[model samples]
Target: MSKRAVILAAGVGQRLQLAADAPAPKCLLRFDGRTLLERHLRLLRAVGVEDVVIVVGYEHQQIADELDRLDWTPRPTLILNPQYRQGSVVSVAAAESALCAGGDVLLMDADVLYDVRMLAALVADDSADRLLLDAGFEAGDEPVKLCLRDGRPVELRKKVADGLRYDHVGESVGFFRFTQASATRLAQIVRQYAQTQRGGEPHEEAVRDLLLESPERFACADVTGLPWLEIDFPVDVIRAREVVLPQLHPLL
Candidate 1:
């Protein structure tokens, strides 16, 4: 059972330029009143993942203040990613202690607007290394895909190479479950990147490295038809509020 989670919320969000009503850190973006951060904490808490570690940078204090405002039970730990501007992987690697010490950890992206069922599916799965997938995402080079052959994740990338054959492919929910051993290994992989020129690469690189190295270590559950969207570009923010939010089960 994964009892803890590491949320990467450190990026500058340069692409998601909003008007005057902009959310400085992006995690504070609200849907119908509750922020994405609030929603993430609430849903994770509801699913029994009480111990959370959030990596903060780029308006980190605002996030800290938001945490104080929420005062969520079993307080979440906040880690500062000094090089948040460099790459997403640094944010993940910044929480190395949380990822490596825990028995199993759920790794997540904080900018996502999703239904509670999305969290529910991952918590219920006992797989050592698990990925949440959605077959309904719009096709493009944007979404990180989980390519499966015979139901096992063989590749995790934005674009699959020329001759790869996969029976199933879906957009990664950017939420994952990693067992203790795998989590420790993943931490090692990214920590090295955090110290090198490769630190600029997205966090997905480390995840894919592990996935391709040990394809048998990963399994995925499809959450297609579930309303969810990663709040990246301004257009996505509109989609989240108009499309994804209305479909979510109301906050309890």
Candidate 2:
């Protein structure tokens, strides 16, 4: 049983702009002599995911050129989201369109790094709509907060919750394994928000809305104590180098 995966990599990392010399997108940034995108692709390949789609924007041509330069074998399809400047939801939409055929879609962010076991765990779960959770954090720390009830997310991105156990992590390091209903709903959510024309709002807002609207369909694949990091600012680069790179060396 094979699965399809899509990486939403089209966002412009405004934080990296603080540094003038580093012209590469965060995905193109290298750690231990391998680019972040390369690392992600390698991990996916190792785990038996061959049908990958990368949504490219914010110097998309640079990403394409880099891919050409490296000539990564068994290359996955690349789709350009013209509305990438609009928001990540648009990128998600683009990836959704590039599916070519229908199957479960594993949605992920390109800026996040996670352990192979965590990826395996999420992929292994036979749930309809699953989320990889990092239920270990103080309030207001995790950049993307998930509010859950009965071991599944009930609300998303809400800062304060009385009955919810929220441990804020830098990013959502888990994969969204979609069923047919989930895939349709996820695509519809993207289309809805994309039409609203709210530029630069976080994609997680739309995702939270989706989860809240239909909480019963979502399941929690709690991935605590896994090595994960979100690459946003220069500090994240340091953290990725210190933490993710070391753990990933054997795989690379």
Candidate 3:
């Protein structure tokens, strides 16, 4: 079976822009000497992911130009999500064709910086559907939260109040691994969701809905110690550089 990955990088990252005079797309932002997108691609490649499909919309041409300059093997296939401003789920929906291409599909946000071990752990797990969970997570209203029951996710939501009630909750790391069957089903679910709700539904909510509808389909892997940072704000970038990067060691 082939292994494929999808990177959702179409957002404008309005929050990060507050810190920079002329900000690029979040994926294109530099950390240390390499761009976040570069690190993600290299890490994916290192973990034996054969093909990559990147969804681009906000500043699509800039991302394209960067890809054009790279000489990396197994070149990424770019899919355009014209409705990027609507919701992140649109980008995942845009890559449905690629996701259904008969393989384990790895889906991740582009704004995160993570050690390769996180990917390795996800890939190593044989679950049909799995999500990376950070047990040592800091609570915030915006971060997606997961409630786990016996190592499997029972609930996932973004509201802080909803998650605060659970004792066994973990924060979602915006990384997922789906078997081909689950990927196909997810594509169908997103399509149906798009038809009913115009836009603005987060992709994580769709996944949460899927898990709730079929609790037997998903599991969670605790990746608490693995260094990773989701770069949403300027402070997150500093944390990624000062805290997460140093721990990553030889991976960077």
Index of the highest-lDDT prediction? 1
RMSD of each: 1.3, 2.8, 2.0
Model 3 scores worst on lDDT over the 10 consecutive residues at 159-168
Off by over 4 Å in 3: 18-21, 160-167
Runs of candidate 1 with Cα error greater than 4 angstroms are 19-23
Q: TM-score of every model?
A: 0.96, 0.87, 0.93
lDDT for each of the candidates? 0.88, 0.71, 0.83
Model 2: per-residue lDDT, tens digit, 179-247?
Answer: 656777777777777777753566677677778788887777767777787777878888888866677
Task: Give one digit per residue, the lDDT tens place, for model 1 in 107-204.
Answer: 99999998899888887767668889999878899999888999888788999887999999989999988888889999999999988888999999
lDDT of 3: 0.83
Which ten contiguous residues of candidate 1 have the minimum total lDDT? 17-26
State how far residue 66 of model 3 sits from its true place (Å).
1.3
Q: Candidate 1: global Cα-lDDT?
A: 0.88
Point out where model 2 deviates above 4 Å: 161-171
Among all candidates shown, the one with the greatest TM-score? 1
